[model samples]
Target: MSSEHERGDKKGQFCSIPAKPKCGDCPHPKDYIEVCKPTGWFDHTFKRFVNAKDPFTFEKKFEAHHLVCVAPVTQILLSNDGINSVIEQTKWCINNKDNMIAMPLWGHTVKWYCEVEESISVDEVADVINDAMKAPKFKNIPQHDYDHNCKEGYTWEVEVEVEKLADKVKEQGHKLKGKALEGKLNKLSSDFRSRLLDDRGTRKGGTHAAWKLAQKEPPDPDWCQPFSMASDSKVSSKGFPVRVFNGQVAKWVNRIAKAISSGV
Candidate 1:
């Protein structure tokens, strides 16, 4: 394994990324995956709020690999160059048995409450989070996570954490939603998710709540068009009205006029 601390020039060890990198990944996606980041934020630096930012953490793609990549985002460097350089130099120190040097070029920092590779779904990464870290003797997240170590006064809100974890699991089931709009719309909180989703909904004039939309349901083919009306009708032998609709409306001008005047 590469020594995270021992590199001669530690300048790029944790590259100071620019506002937006070439890679498309973001710790904050246009629509962040819900539940994963929504819950379990234990504030260490400032007064905590519901859904406050939590320190990022992730399980590496490979068991032995330490370096991983994410897509572009606010904190990533101007490009992948800085992280690429760091990865190259680190390869010399670590065995890099899995040839993970390519990740820096393709990914970004795993700097959210939770994250995974550029292509992996949050569900996949989250599913094995426990198993992947267990054998490696890594800490469990949110509660036991060491990234944002809790001091004596730092509170562990079990109820809030449990809510977030449950919400995260429920969010994974909504993979059909666009990445930009997954978990940001809980009815309960006015945190970032609610705010971001509401703003996005207004900006695009779309339904703010994703679940309220029926994307899989077929469109009403005749919607917005006038409903057909029978130009003429007669009593059938069975006593049911025998109606025929025709496009020759002028033939029934007086009737059509009466129908239109009646608000039919």
Candidate 2:
């Protein structure tokens, strides 16, 4: 998960220059150096994991090596600075590319992967872009700090909620194991995942209650980019702030839940 950065912090700053240089728009020398691609596109992603002992069976769609937890598919930003500074400012981001993704009972192993499904530009996915040409030169705006370390104990809160349900089942003299336990746990966890991953609540015209007018808009861009972080001090001579998106660090919260319930 990502952490929130307090405003005005130097660590939350990002270069103000747009990804692409506009002819008359940018006041800098027309030949200014561009380290990042203005309209870069990704064509593939990679994923790797070890087999799990007691995987999940409820969501067949999410099954992997008998484990319920799996890495989410996302794009990576490869920078020279050893993976920090780039997206750490954003909230809800993973802090490290390679780390143990812990659940309530156990930690699952995962490898970094990158796959870009659509051809989108940097301007398309960036949260905000400076195109007005009125912003200051050599400016560093504060980015939302998303370097929260949620890899471990991410499901603690959710596990507590499920524990209550398990106790109720126990009070009824029912065995909270096998399919019966799996069914109940599945509904709760599935719903929780949906709420966490859903974006409809944040849309402009939610539910399409009323029609809105707008000019011919380009294809809706894929803005879901996952970021990882590095230390604060200058780590590389290259001076790049952002690093490539390592594989997603997904938590298998369900398998652990079952383990805890059955005392495994």
Candidate 3:
């Protein structure tokens, strides 16, 4: 087993943990996951109006073998690198595991965050993000915004695809109102899923990239330099959705721990 001091150099690029070399300068737990709650204006406003409660805390702890990866939840939901970031981080956690590493869990919810040690210019980050957003996964985003519920934030890729289907119908000179349009979308969605259920092509775009990366040979040193969404339905009357905490972190950690113990 590695000493707590040794874990610092082994942490992921975006790890939320305090760096081992710098741990003496901080008071946070050296072995536990740290929830990041930035003090920016957007975050402050959201918490003030939406989720007034403090960040979630977990009663459960991670096993020694766990090498968890955390991503910036806000960036993944709104930035150009959103999809790419999650998939990339997940793959990193999976591919970099060793015998001591087990139950590679990833945190994707809004409260999670990551940082880079090296200084990177905003423009460089934006360029990579723009490229990610332009990937085939988001090809169907309409030229114009069809839904005006920006209060809850932008819709997911699935919603964008449904809107695209509606646009195609409109282009064909067929006007279907309300239920009729809803029915058509339902059918389209069902058909699309049915066809893709057994095909690897269904995982195209960001997911596909992650899948491909996982298949490649592991890095010689098993290390790499660090690089660094919300649903509407549950919106509160405050005009934004409040974050939900339901022991998810504990569940995730336990699931991974179980897998490792079972030799999975």
Candidate 4:
């Protein structure tokens, strides 16, 4: 029988442990897996938060040593199954509503939090570490108000558009009364402002030039007639009627308006 099979038989399970490399110098997967297990387990532990699970219970029950115990299991899961599965499983844990709300046994919840905190995309833990490393004095110092200078003119125009759009949309039987509507308008305005800024700065002349260069002959649809509305003039395309007034564009406009008003 193969050594690997023999080892598996001894362990009493068909586990996928890698063979240790010869020459006493090569790094074994087992060692690396062991080392990384804690991080993976921690990731799993925190995943509970996303599903509305009470993480505090698990946190209280498991001391630091327990974290160490689950690390290898986490590593094994991650290596065998893949990260996406890990993420999905954790999500399932969080979404399990049938369990006791006070003290859930959902392993998935803990896993999800750990993944979010330590995972490549969210990296909450890394962000915390980075924030901690930053000089505390820097927090007190005011940030450079570059947006005030660069976006002041654009912001005013956008705000006018937002107010106009809000009025227009309200007239069209869309409810712009609630906080949610206001928030949507604000976001729409901000998005419009950002698009305008980007268009004006980077892609304005270049986009035209590129289009001109790409054409084999004269354009099929004449470029002289404006193809689309400018950022401030465009109505939101969001499906929600209320959101049309207070989406990304409106938010940006509001910010600009606030900045301008504060300055004055």
Candidate 5:
């Protein structure tokens, strides 16, 4: 039979031997020798001997073979560098086609045997195997660093400065205490003014009392009053009421008013 058919048969069959014959002492052996097995021998030998090993170990071997088989199919999908290396190796294989088998298992098994036999070093074979295995995952190469920054690209900077300005609102004492006092003063002023308006309307005439009383009633479920001033006033003896007329404070108040008007 042809060598390929003979190898195929050997891998598919099993036969019993009298005993483990010594290579140097066999009577029928000559200077040159060829060992051959019938069809299904390797499969049967594997089932009887190799399968007895731990299942996890056998699974890893199966996975390795699977990776090797899938490698060539994905070679073109890899990067330029990876594709070039595979193309070069394939060209070499083409030139040596007469001496080699192109089947995935044959290629992978030959590579393994070559490395074990020292016909090729482990490192050299490993480089080729690694490139092949990585061919499928080549598209997912990382482009960013761990710090969320780009590599070999633009850099960024932040600048900050501290400066003093005139007429700034400076709370010389405790800021929380100052804000409490200011809130109390605003509440007191609002309550006093509202009371004055009510008394003034009562003194004006009875005609204005109805309108004033209606305004003083709580607002409707859907409609609301524009302002609801608080009724409390407490401030430090040294504190005086001051109103901002310009700059940042005015801008801040304008922003707050706009936000409130937007109902957001």
Candidate 6:
């Protein structure tokens, strides 16, 4: 995630000049530079793991492996610097031709993924992406004194092995009602993945109500996406000044994962 210079701490701040400038809209560009697109649209995304274990019996349309997704959940920008950082990051994805997705309310591209060669199996995709996150570029962002606008030191990402999780689900027994299985997988989602689907897809009055309601009613088959959990959820607000979002480095990351995990 990127950040902006604090409004109060306007030390080296300049008016945000918006345009497709060479600066790529970085908060305060040291020099005009452009983010390079990667080799190809597929290359831009780092294909993460997919569940290839025993198939989820609930659905026959698409197998478990086909439905399981491992898209990277880009961090939320709590500060101005964070905002700038995500903007730059999204630019990098677009320039690189990756799957750049913009979400509601937040108003920024927050998720990215890769498409592996057709020959690659789900397990292989999982292995490759899991390894890729460890690269120098994808490693966790640590807060530096100069990262002035970040709420905390840095945002961290979690790599979930869908196949392994699926294996566990099988071990736990798959003979369950649609709702029971959905609940079981949902519990796992809360522990691992981003809760964007849980919040936006299942809620009635949130920003994406139309999109959520458009889907078929009742039990959601996709365990990894929205778990078909009910709304009535109350999201606890965690602003920057709020202690819930202060101090500890990973505090905000955890809070973000939890706040969005409404259905779970």
Ten residues in sequence with the least summed lDDT for candidate 2 = 207-216
Candidate 6 weakest ten by summed lDDT: 59-68
**Where does candidate 3 stray beyond 4 Å?**
1-54, 58-160, 172-174, 178-180, 191-264
lDDT string for model 3 (28-127, tens) is: 3332222221122112110111222764434222222211212121122112231323222321121111211111112211112112101334444333
Measured with C-alpha atoms, the lDDT of residue 244 in candidate 6 is 21
TM-score of each: 0.15, 0.25, 0.21, 0.19, 0.12, 0.18
Model 1 misplaced regions, further than 4 Å: 1-148, 151-168, 171-176, 179-264
Which order, best to worst by TM-score?
2, 3, 4, 6, 1, 5
Candidate 4, which ten residues in sequence have the lowest lDDT sum?
92-101
Model 5 worst lDDT run, 10 consecutive residues: 157-166
C-alpha lDDT of candidate 1 relative to the true structure: 0.22
Q: How does residue 100 of candidate 3 score in lDDT? A: 14
Which of the two candidates, 1 or 2, achieves a greater TM-score against the reference? 2
Go through the candidates in order and give the C-alpha RMSD of each one to the true structure: 27.3, 25.5, 24.5, 26.5, 42.7, 24.0
lDDT of each: 0.22, 0.23, 0.26, 0.27, 0.21, 0.25
User: TM-score: which is higher, 3 or 5?
Assistant: 3
* Ranking of all candidate structures by their lDDT, best first: 4, 3, 6, 2, 1, 5
Better of 3 and 4 by lDDT: 4
The whole-model C-alpha lDDT of candidate 5 against the native structure comes to 0.21
- Model 2, 109-193: lDDT tens digits are 1111101112334344222222211221101111111112233222333434444654555465554443554355455545543
lDDT tens digits by residue: candidate 6, 114-229: 11213344445434433542222211211111111223211121213333433443455544324453344344444422333334233443322221222223312231122221
Model 3, total clashes: 0
Candidate 2 stretches with Cα past 4 Å from truth are 1-43, 46-153, 175-179, 199-264
Better of 1 and 6 by TM-score: 6
